[model samples]
Target: MQKSFLIVVIVAIVGGLAIHQFVPALSASIAFFAGAIIAALLFKLLPSALSQGDGEYSGPMMTLYVGNLPYRVHEGEVKELFSQYGEVCSVRLVRDRKTGRRKGFGFVEMPEASAQQAMAQLNDFVFQERTIKVREAKTQDSDSTEKNPV
Candidate 1:
């Protein structure tokens, strides 16, 4: 049993070295496959492992609130401006329900990773002659009016 184990280890080492030296692409392919398998395993196992503690934790997609927009700046303009940073999912410019006029504020939705970068770069950015305020959007429940009663 001991001899067989030793022989197997020696054969694996020699075969790995041979593959690395003679067929470098094959070694890279093996590494890619191994990495993919590990990633798949982690994806399958990590959420359940993490949820055992308190509650299931999931990261929220990034949504940015953009304020002080020039009234002329529409959804297309906002989308165009943000697309420079990343893939913009949607742009919603707030409008008055009665008058159908822009309210100078809007929300922009993007993937989490790109949204962070965009927020950092675009906050207080001068667009259409106005310094726009860009930051993570607050949900309705978190709005100050709910906490402070008049």
Candidate 2:
């Protein structure tokens, strides 16, 4: 990981310098493109290498549906449970606004890599006589029940 980061930094500097030296007029454009390439490579490559080449996780904020949470479980407990695997960015318990009571499920957001690890380690594991379900949260719009209201 260190080696890759060093290599990327070196390439960015060398590329920037070469472009500036040979094409003074287009130096800005050349430098911008070179920097962009380096940034993308670093973002896509660094995490994977750090994880011993397991490959980096990608994409936007992911929501994980956690079921089998003890009925008395709260947001803090949820965060604490997942924090063991990775940083828990947020834990939002779905609840009724009127009564402020849980809906028996929640969404958890963590870095994709951490989320993947958590899923592998936690999914289907027995908990208080109920098998927990950990999966990528599905969007409401994708629910067929919502699209075709009875």
lDDT by residue (tens digit), candidate 1, 1-150: 344334444545555565557767776557445545554455456645433544322455788999999998879999999989887888999999999999999999988888999999999999989999999999986687779866
Tally clashing residue pairs in candidate 2.
Answer: 0
**Best-fitting candidate, scored by TM-score:** 1
Could you report the Cα RMSD, in angstroms, for every candidate shown?
A: 14.5, 8.3
lDDT values of the candidates? 0.77, 0.76
Backbone clash numbers for all candidates listed:
0, 0
Kindly give the stretch of ten consecutive residues in candidate 2 with the minimal lDDT sum: 49-58
**Model 1 poorest ten-residue lDDT run:** 49-58
How would you encode candidate 2's per-residue C-alpha lDDT over 62-148 as one tens digit per residue?
Answer: 679997666677788778878899878789888878987777778899888888888888898766566778998888877977889
**TM-score between model 2 and native:** 0.52
